[model samples]
Each structure stands twice: as structure tokens, then as C-alpha cells.
Target: MALAATVAGAPVHAQDSDWLSYRDAYRGMVAFEKYGKPKQFLQQHYQVGARDGSPLPVDFRLALSGKTMQLNLPLDAVGRAVFPLLKAAYDENAVLTVNRKLGAYVFRPRISIVVRPDGVYEGAELRAACEQALDFQRTVNAAGYRDKHCVGVRFTFAKKPDADVRWKGGAPLPAVPGPAFPDEAGNAYSVVTVRFDAATDKGQVVSQNAPLAVSPVFE
Candidate 1:
């Protein structure tokens, strides 16, 4: 509960100018499609535990910019969250006793990219960057065990190319429609992609490769 309470107080980082439009597009997508309701009980009340029957309480926060979703979890809190979740999912009387061992909870988020304008997009680069960030967080948390605090977090993105090229000064870009992804409970999430074009001084479209689609990955 403290974790959830603290999340609202967490300072959000300044969003990138180039990526701001994408964020709006993502919001629009959520509005048009029904992603259903989030598992408020699980997120707010569940506690992770270890096989030894030790309890873990992890605090988590999330943010989206461009095609990336950054997940922040305090080290101690993450350790707490993972253990309990694992305990509930696994058998307590099993010979292996998988829950006894302590390990890092790695969060790797990914996005599907669709480019409509037909240009070479650095999909691999984006994927790699997200993976690296997730890996690094795992490492940091592991190393900080001496302090009894480890923050296990993940960053992932799904990218899609946008074809909507109309953008007037101070106006939001148009939204592109798309299918929805269902969660563990079979609820659908409506995802939309919004594209912005880089233009020259004379208003000539320079590149369609600008960053597209920004929204909460797990909302």
C-alpha cells in the first residue's frame, strides 16, 4: 500500500519533444478501444514470497516515452514482490522446492513495429536497447544485495510505423487504428499508432522515420 501511495508522488521525467505526439496518439488509442479494467487487486494487494516462506514486498512505477516503457521498482520492494508471486504460482510441497532459491525478477517489455510508409526502421536497435536496459537493472539489483535492497525493473517497447502525415503547428497528429492485445484474464487492449513527420523549413517532408507511438505498455 505504501508503494502504491508513493507512486503518485514519484516525479515524472520530462518527455521528449519529438516523442510527445506519440504519447498523445497512444492515449487516443486507449480511448477508442476497450482494454478492459486493470487487475487492481493484484497490483495493489498481492505480495511475492520465497520458497522458505519469506515475504517480499516490491514497489513499482511505470512511464512511457516514444516506443519505450520504463519500469521503476525499489530494490527491496522488488525482491518482496517477486517471491510472493512465485510462491502462489508454484507447488509448495514439491521436492525441488523452487521457491526457496532467491533470484532476480527480470522484466523485459517488447513492442510490435509496423511501418506503413515503407522505410528502413532500426527495429533491432530499439529492441536491443530495451533488452540492455532491463539486463542492467537486474545487475544493479543483484549487486546491491549487501544493502538488503535491490531494484529489479524492466524496459520494453513495441514499435509501429505511422502513415498519418498531417500535423499543423500546435495540433496533435492523427491517430491510426489497430487490433487489441488480451491480457492474462482475456481482456482486450486497444492499441493505436500515431506518426509524425520531420519537415524542412519550406514544409517539405524530410523523413517519415520519426519516433511513433508512445503509450503505457502494460495499461
Candidate 2:
């Protein structure tokens, strides 16, 4: 909430820039923090991904630094970090940096469903969460989202073949190689996308291995 604000029309060019302005990133994210809507089941993360759709380096990490504060933000396998909303950092106009000299990387805010510790998720609950995300998206920037609809959720797992995501007491959901988050680069992981429909809405999804993240799919 302490981020100085920007919105849809803000520039996101990354052609020659090596680092991202934390003030700009915060402005984009503060909308979610200020949104008074149903978002209990969703979470936001600061994401850094390759601009050219290339796979991220194995040691990829984000750095949040300011005049008085220097913090290392470790990225998950998919390049997401739990962004710190610090008033001091905002006051000093911190910057988010990747490995020095690292280019072709872009930064954005990501929203996804909260992963449950038990690896069990109710289908209806998933639908509700997706709706909540979609609704909130419209409040800030409704451009492409104005006519879109939530169709399903995509669960991205580790970069391996044996992800083991399936419907409760049913066959495994077919998974394809894809990125863990939207607009991300590289098909580095197995992704199982479950559609919201009568056959699945009343059931449950059981993930044998914990997913890196589950994102709502809008179409």
C-alpha cells in the first residue's frame, strides 16, 4: 500500500533497461491493496520474467534496494518473489534489480490462488476465487478483461514430468508443458489446466505434489 502509484497506461518497455523502478511496480500493485473486494482466496506477488520468452537462469533473483535498505528477494522456480511493501523503501524510491548486467527481463505484479497446505482444493471454491480475481482486475484496468470470462485455473508445477495432478478419486488431468505464470517465458514446467464446468464444479482437485502456483485463466 505504500507504493507510489501508476496504472494501465504506464510504460513497461524493457528494451535497454536492466532494472525496474520499485516505485512504478508499487504503483501497479497498490491497486490490489486498495481494492475493497472479495480477494481472500487470492495472493499477489512481484514477478520477474524474461521479455523474450527465454528460460530464466538457475540462480535468478530479484534485488530490492534503496538509500538505506538493501534486501535480496529470492525468486521461485518461476521467477516470483513475495514483494515487500515497505514504507521506508517507498520513501527512498527503491529499485528492483536482477543480477547485474542481466537484461531482457521484465517486471510485473502477479495474482494467483493461495496454495493449500493439504494439496486439496474444492472446485466451487476455485471458481469463486477466479471470479474474485477477474472482478478485481476490472476495477483497476479493464482493457482486455472487459469482455473476458474466467474459464479455468492453471496449476503449474516443478519442471518435471511427474507432476501428478488429478481430480479427486478420478483420472489424472492431462498436463502440458507451459510457464507457471501468465505472460511468463519458457515452457519449463508441467501445467494442468482444469476447466470450470458442471462435471468438475461439484468435485475436487487433488494435487499429489504441491504446485508452484495456480493462476486463474480468463478467456
Best by lDDT: 2
Instruction: Quote the lDDT for 177 in model 1.
Output: 32
- TM, every model: 0.19, 0.89
Alpha carbon lDDT at 151, candidate 1: 20
Give candidate 1's error at residue 53 in angstroms: 28
Candidate 1 has an lDDT of 0.24
Worst 10 residues of 2 by lDDT: 1-10
Clashes per candidate, residues 3 or more apart or on different chains: 18, 0
In the predicted model 2, the residue pairs found to clash are: none
For model 2, what is the error of residue 210's alpha carbon versus the real structure, in angstroms, after optimal superposition? 0.2
Angstrom error of the Cα, residue 121, model 2: value is 0.6
Any idea what lDDT model 2 has? Answer: 0.79
TM-score top scorer: 2
Per-residue lDDT of candidate 2, residues 114-147 (tens digit): 9999999999999999999889878877785799
Worst 10 residues of 1 by lDDT: 1-10
Runs in model 1 lying further than 4 Å from the true structure: 1-120, 140-186, 191-219
On residues 129-204, what C-alpha lDDT tens digit does candidate 1 reach at each position? 3333333323333342223321211111122333323222324233333322111111111233222223222232
